[model samples]
Target: MTVQPYVPEPLPPAGIDWEAHIPRIASANRALARYDGILQAIPNPRLLLSPLLTQEAVLSSRIEGTQASLEDVLRFEANPKEPIGDAALADIREIINYREALNTAVEALKTRRLDLALVCDLHRVLLSGSRGMDREPGCVRTIQNFIGRDAQIEHAIYIPPAPEDLSGALGDWEAYLQGGELDVLVQLSVLKAQFELIHPFCDGNGRIGRMLVPLILYDKGLIGSPMFYISAYLERNRPVYYERLLAVSRDGDWNGWIAFFLHAIEEQAGANGRKATAILDLYDEMKQTVPEVTRSQYAVAALDALFKTPIFSSAEFFEQAAIPRRAAERILQQLREHGIIAVLAEGGGRRAATYAFPRLLAITEGDRL
Candidate 1:
């Protein structure tokens, strides 16, 4: 049987209880205000930490899909110890893939408006090979499905509007963004909620919803880049995440969900900002001591990718870093020379030696999940 898409019913006649979410709205505003202060106060002094936070955000978001216990996922992410189960492993890989999509989306945002095309591309990247979306890359789901408490699949929950609705909705979102009537952080929450309510695609609705948040922010000139990830925050607050989403559907509680969503953003943004700051400090300290004279300028980028995937081998390094084989080798050595990283050889030429960013790897292995 084909895996059809899930969609909520059309906007109900009673209208959403937009006002009921006032408390969340207030809290969200406070968080966003705090986050904005940090964003303005910390930069250049913290620019380099962007890659690390970006990697963590993307990976943490993917972990949310694993259905793993939130505590377990956070434990694994904070300091992965003992091999994770196969399902969790799969989710981690998916998260890593999302990070790639995020990188692409962020770069694209810099050059183009955050239109449906960019959103479609993000869906394509996120749902590239999953059973969701029937592997159409960016196709929307025409059918409707639902998830019961036991993970039971139910059809006929709600039918999604035709693909044309997506274009219309996205246009409205873009207009609101351009008008500056809505605050950037609050707008991101509302836009993400609206996108999910629209449920444009037949598959990967959640992932796409999450991706839309940062894309909107980046496009609106809110964030310097797409380094913040709400998945971790949402996953931590999964119960409220689902409840508020449903509230929007049941009572049109837009204000509530928007508030919660913005709060998620504010919280994640600060966490990301701090994480980025720490990583940047580490990178700068390493740079000052490393003899830059011998390494390519690209080495810094390679190091960035290290935090992105702190436990990979050289082959994996070159792929994400997008550097040539020989240059990658030279750069790896440079990292080792600065004591920023070390080799993990299996000895006796029996296997390929692996490289690890010792401190960053340690953090992933023991902290910052």
Candidate 2:
């Protein structure tokens, strides 16, 4: 017997039993508020939190079977010629696309609402020059698609709505996004699960769905910016994440999924808060350290540039730090000697060496140096 496609019910799914989820909802909200407070306190969140964003892109893509690590992506960006192999390079590009797509959406959200047009725009950026580029980026599926372990529909785990139904389904989803709910965080849980169930795009549905988490939070004014990093939690709990989503479609288990999602929000928000606070503290420490080590007027500028791009080239650092040629070279040597930065690749001839701020990178990776 063939498996029939799963047609999702319209948004605001009935019988959610929101009353039972009150405790989870409250906890999730408190944790998220605390995280947002940390974000507000950061002097330059976009710069300091950039590595976290990249890590999110890596983990989100990893959930979809990509094999690149956070360090792999950063090292590649610092020097594209690193012989990490074609397959690894491909994965890195996908991660890069994820970051670009996210940054694009954040900027677009500044002047527009989170609607389908903007979503399609993000889809285009997401799959550009990547594995799914041929799968019709920026366009909704015009044919049937399914989630399965094999190509045979008989072995499918889940099948999304038929192509003919996508427009109406998505329209309803967008309308629900604009309306109010019992609680914004619980409402977000619904929105995310519904999008995953709908499986709107042909190849990037999972990633795009995850991307919406931060975007929605920002658009709803829950965060100072679209910088939340929830993928770490989801990726860590990969099996349960999918199980909760599937449970919603399989058994009308919205409350269960909402409870799980709220927990994810609460837990990841605390983790994100701690990581962000660590980065801020390191920045404060480096302020005095860089000045003392380099004893240069450009020490603060150099420190800021490092946080913005922890892995950078010597030439790139000079330009970004905006120090004079000789002075910047001296400062790099001083930082290298003092173990403030480590050389990832050495400069030779016209090729500038790559460096890594291991302290900052370790904090972003949630690892000790």
Q: For this target, which candidate reaches the highest lDDT against the unseen true structure?
A: 2
What value does the lDDT take at residue 248 in candidate 2?
85
Global lDDT of model 1: 0.59
> What tens-digit string does per-residue lDDT give for candidate 1 at 202-258?
666677777667667657665655545567677668889878876765666766776
lDDT of each: 0.59, 0.90
TM-score of model 1 vs. true structure: 0.69
C-alpha TM-scores of all predictions: 0.69, 0.97
CA displacement after TM-score superposition, residue 72 of candidate 1 (Å): 15
Which residue runs does candidate 2 get wrong by more than 4 Å? 367-369
Range of the 10 consecutive residues with the lowest summed lDDT in candidate 2: 360-369
